[model samples]
Target: MANIVSYLAREQRTFEEEPFNMVDGLVMATLAYLRYERYDRLPARPSEPFRLHDVLALASWRDLLAGSWMRDAADSRSFLRALMASRRYRDAFVSFYVSESSDAVEKQFSAITLTVGDGCVYLAFRGTDGSLAGWKEDFNLCFMDVTPSQQAAVAYVSGVASALPGRIVLTGHSKGGNLAQYAALCVASDVYGRITRVCNYDGPSFLGDPSPRVGDPTYRAMLFKAVPESSLFGMILEDGSDYHVVQSSAMLIFQHEPFSWLVSDGDFLYRDGLTRTALWADGTLDGWLKTRTPEQRAQFIDTIYDFVAASGVKTAADLHRNFGSIVMSVASSTAKLDPETRAFILDTFKALVGVVGRETAKSIDPRTRIRLPRRRESYDGSRPADFARSLRPAADGSQLAEAGKPSHAEPDGLQLAGAGGPCPAKADGVHPAKADDLRLGECGASLPVPCPSAPSPEASPAACGGVLDKD
Candidate 1:
């Protein structure tokens, strides 16, 4: 099925002709006007709302696209180019009240208001950007009751609703969706009464119980949550309001991309239910999270944020590009954690692994029981030939291959991969033995043999020993 861009290009009918649908929700959510570095450059709100043509007339679309942190400039450009040219959205949708803020100590929030047709107004909240602080706030939601972004959303919604006279339709993608729901709930009864629908497109769930106002029949009836078949972010914490599963062309975590969502005839192609992969992940995450106390969860969240911050990258894209360095930073931070906190982190990781292992085991055939082989003492790390001799066939009908050998080759001896001589240096310039020590420490595994402080030149090739030998 065609995606949103294709739908916008092909569909000619306006809101006046076809009426508002999920397709319109997707279009509003895709707006990157909040990412514009200079909001002052744009036309004023309400009194001088900018039409799609007017915004494009400013010749600042390229600058605005470049300023976006969450989406690629090309994608943003393509979407806007399609939007401005479309008969469906170009004339009907006009933007106003754009706001954005990034306060690491407080909150990261951005939103915009759009006038759709004559009587309806669409409040579009931007989702998490590339800011590390924004992501941290999202993780904080796992423990905290109300985030700063949610509070800002409430204030923005209330202020905008009072000033504008129309049937309000709240909409957002990702964290924006979460804000939309929270703001809708926090508004006064009269303000809430003006809201016709609250469309949450793959938004996450609140940590604790929702406000009593959300439980009111009138408010609950206005909620509309839609998620992709293999949703990850949308399935976090809880599945609030009965969610509609939409088909997506992307797989796994990439399904979170709204562009991947399948659209047909200006509406999302509905799926019967969430995909099995989504359910499995949701269940596994929920199960692992249940094993941790509230304090533990908070600590875990803090530790993650601390590590990310320690990397000195402000955006997720930068962090991902420098992942190797970030990992090293994380390892250094892990080493510095207090004994108790370190143990808690390790134990929490082990529990998560156990959950995944159990689920994996359940999916395997009953007749083929799986077990890890016991460590061997005779395996000498120094001798490549002797290490290969200790190899055995696994239950999966595969034999361990010698290091640096072809996958089909039989194990000949214990030798570090890419290590040509007795004492091979790892890619990081550290000795293989020392590198193994760091790996073992990171995994909380006891070193079977003490690692040498330095590589010994005089040591015999047959006398070498380490985790590689035992493996």
Candidate 2:
């Protein structure tokens, strides 16, 4: 079925001609997921706004989008190539960009600005990447009141809006969409009023009821949200706000992908409401969440994160790759946790298992589940391994990165060192914190301040990166 990529390839209308619609927003959101941090040809904080044509002029779509999306890498790259070439966005200015990722802290946030010369600028916030996918986001959000990413979103918009005098529009896919609305609600009144619209495509909602904080008529009038008929990500902890339903080409959990959302005539194929299975899944999630207090949920996520960190598995794919080892590692670590904490974590998974039993579960990626020997490494010469080798953990478990290098890892196997890439020798004395700063320079934080720090090493620099994929 036709999707956003198809729309980009087919649509020639400019913002002046047809106006910016949800389809355009989705394309921008997907482009926002592109990891510009990897290319040295482009500065992280460009002094002048970078035009879409400039990006297309530098690299082929494949190099620009290598290792961007965890799920729809090919489709996303295609969408990007078409976007950079399309008359609609070729002249658009993309600036004030920042992207950060830290396994040390379990959050990934990034945003970019798109100026289409239409008196409006789009603040495209990134959603989750491969590392922080559907399940990780669901678990981590249980305890966060306002994540560093959300705060950064507020600050990011505030900073950009203060600098640029155009009408503001906030949009994102997945968690990014959620941030667009959240930032709209929380940003200062003047900036909030400047925001003409906020588009949320399949992004989850906040931890608590946000209605009390939502006081602006501007916000209410500008909000636009859509979810797939069988969404799992969008419905999680939904705020009971109205949203349109769109038919999807994917099934059940995977319907969270905007690439799968059916598009026709520049709009989604509308549905009346979520599918019955989606309602059940949403109810199941709500029930499980209610069963645990915020504190319990927080503790449970912490416990799991602590376990994974201790296990020395860099990504979730690491756990699945050597199931026996992970099982043993988890067993050993489970004994360290207090009985209450262990029980809580177990109960949460127990509920998830129950939900899965009602419907068959599919693995995220089959290749990630298996280990490839160094000799067996394979790729089209561009993918996760190149990025992974750049950010591979140092002797002390800190990620050392070079500026403008794709020094990041996908929790899925693509980031595995075996993906056929040689790590460049590090300049002497690359501290994790310092390396983080360099990487941050390659991928700025986009905010005036660091994203909220998770509890950890006293010196942990606030981490941020160009996070890809919300689901």
Candidate 3:
């Protein structure tokens, strides 16, 4: 299926010919918000708004493409360049009031406003940037009533609303989406009245109690939510707002990329509902989160952030570049944790793994039952490779067949057996299964490789491109 880039290339109609839709708003919001990072070099907000065409004319598209943010800054720039050349969006957006803040102790907030078409203003909030502070605020959403960025968004929206003359449309991707919803709800009655729509493009939901105004029927009606079928970030703490599940070309968590979302004739390809895998993940995560006390949740967040901060990497890009050294630093820091804290961390992780394993095992065919060898009674906090080695049978004892080796046959199919099982080798001498196919644990149930981190809500496939098939 074609995505936004291909959609833009195919459609040549202007706003007058075809009015703006959610997809159009989303593309504009993405471009307007992510490009603010480039404006850091500017002295301040210009007295007059700069049309996208004019901005691209004066600025170096090459240099803008070089600076990285958490999201797809390069692709967003590309889309802007494409939009500037197109009849559809060439004169549609004029950007103004770009600002960004970074406070290690509080949180990070960044936003920009664009006047789209003729009379409507779109306030686009930048989602979590590469800044560690920005990500920390994302975690804070679980506990806090209002994140620092949310507060800033409220103020920004109110101030901008006073100065602008036209109706408003608030929109954002990822954390920016959350901020857009929050700002729209918190704006004064007059400003709120002027809001045409509040579009949340796979933004997270509020966990704790939100403002009473958020529940107002009229306000809720103004909100529009959409998520990809295999969403993770969008499902977190999400409820109330009816969310549209859209088909995405990117796999698994990478579906968070707006560019991966399939577009047809200037609109997204809507799905019936979330994928079964997404539903299972949401249920599993919600259950796990409930098991943790508020204090435990806080501790876990703090501990993880502490480890990340110790590496002295301020941005995700920096961490990506020096991943090896950062990982080593994290390992060293992990070793310094008190025994009790260490135990708590390990036990929590173990429980989470057990949940995933059990859930995965349920999905396998019962007739093809494959049993794993029993695990040892105790587990030290050693490396995974060391633990695997320790599980190996004694030299004199019966040995488990290697991963690809055929061990035994059941009535239904080949069953992997424990030590002393027959090792029937194929003519090629290679095992039937590859190492990657072998699942860890006592049930021999397969599971997808755990993602290193939650995909950025607003990340573009072009920014961090890869594919992982769903299990």
Candidate 4:
């Protein structure tokens, strides 16, 4: 049963399937809650009183600092714990991870291996193959969001590019891809120049072009995004990257898996999709956001920041454990806040859930007009480890191991995988749909997992249920 579940889990992520960002979001929301709860538990006393606004400020700063300073998983967790402890308001909670008896606070790194290069650093969060047994405890607790990671990556690149002027490449799977592109746009020229390519296997799209920092031209040159043809998150927003929609043969949900796209050939196969629907949704949302008198967006940002900071949790893991209770508290308090802001938060929450639910449904069975073979499973049988090994050179291009040349690389070619079931492709190009249009259950039987912070449906196949059940 465990093996079957694992196989299905792997199948769900095959290149043909559309992936959900549920886990990443959950982690972020959980972290927010952790910070908030810890803040409240601190002993009443001392240098400063707890301020909801301070929590907001902390959240804002954390969002801005996610990938900055290049701290791998371990250092990040420790620094955050300490920062929270010292904030006066959280002084009593300062030693949560520390013991007075111990002179030094030991920091723990993720089970994944790290490869640091001259200008780039690569972090491989130990996955199934890695020796990080039980290390993946809370990975699926949240979905990825580029804003935080991009902010950090940009900061990291800015410093590196200034120190060494040359070509640079930023890359990551899922959330990392978004960060790579985001950092490229956020940094200064010297920093961006060092960035030659930004590879995002499948990251959520930007709200639109990044808030142009040093004008628009510089933002356009460095993006190289790719997604499996049936990708869910990859098609979320438009960043203007002519995304290579890979032709995939994977029978199941393929969008979530990266290896599913690796062909025997060294190159990926792709086909264009009717992106108009997706484009429409992107433009609509992005426009609505951008047109918001800066004041409106500011207010919106403030409201969420405040809401999360108020909870005082640290990592996503902390929040997920207690999100239901917290949500109830927020719902109870909503009546006390300004009616307009309260309505906005409630509406936004609904909208977010509806969007994911709807997309997951549609992606699972998009009346697909096209299907193509992405790669043969053989590539993965013996070569996947080797493939990752070659690319494993840290994000900075420092070689981690010698690239084992393949016995024979497959030639790149497109193969049509017959469409399954019903639901013909819509004639309209794949433009973005409105949040309302994205309502789930209107079409599909089951919605993909909702937000990471929310519990998985009780009925979800329990194959690997244990994987996330305890965490």
Name model 3 segments beyond 4 Å from true: 37-43, 66-78, 93-95, 361-471
Which runs of model 4 end up more than 4 angstroms from their true locations?
1-152, 162-166, 186-194, 205-222, 230-232, 247-262, 269-271, 274-305, 308-312, 346-427, 432-471
Local accuracy by lDDT, each model: 0.65, 0.65, 0.64, 0.37
How many pairs of residues in model 3 come into backbone collision? 3
- Choose the strongest candidate by TM-score: 1
Clashing pairs in 2: 99-465, 99-466, 100-464, 100-465, 100-466, 101-464, 101-465, 128-469, 129-468
**Native-to-model Cα distance after best TM-score fit, residue 353 in candidate 1, in Å:** 2.0
Across residues 74-151, which tens digit of lDDT does each residue of candidate 2 receive? 476666668777887767877777876655555577888887756666889987765633335546666666666776
Better of 3 and 4 by lDDT: 3
Reference-based TM-score, model 4: 0.40
Q: Whose lDDT is higher: candidate 2's or candidate 4's?
A: 2
Per-residue lDDT of model 3, residues 266-328, tens digit only: 788999888757765765566566667656777877887888887787877887899998878
Pitting candidate 1 against candidate 3, the one with the higher lDDT is 1
Candidate 1, which segments miss by more than 4 Å at Cα?
A: 32-34, 37-40, 44-48, 67-70, 73-75, 92-96, 362-471
Q: Which pairs of residues collide in candidate 3? A: 404-431, 404-432, 405-431
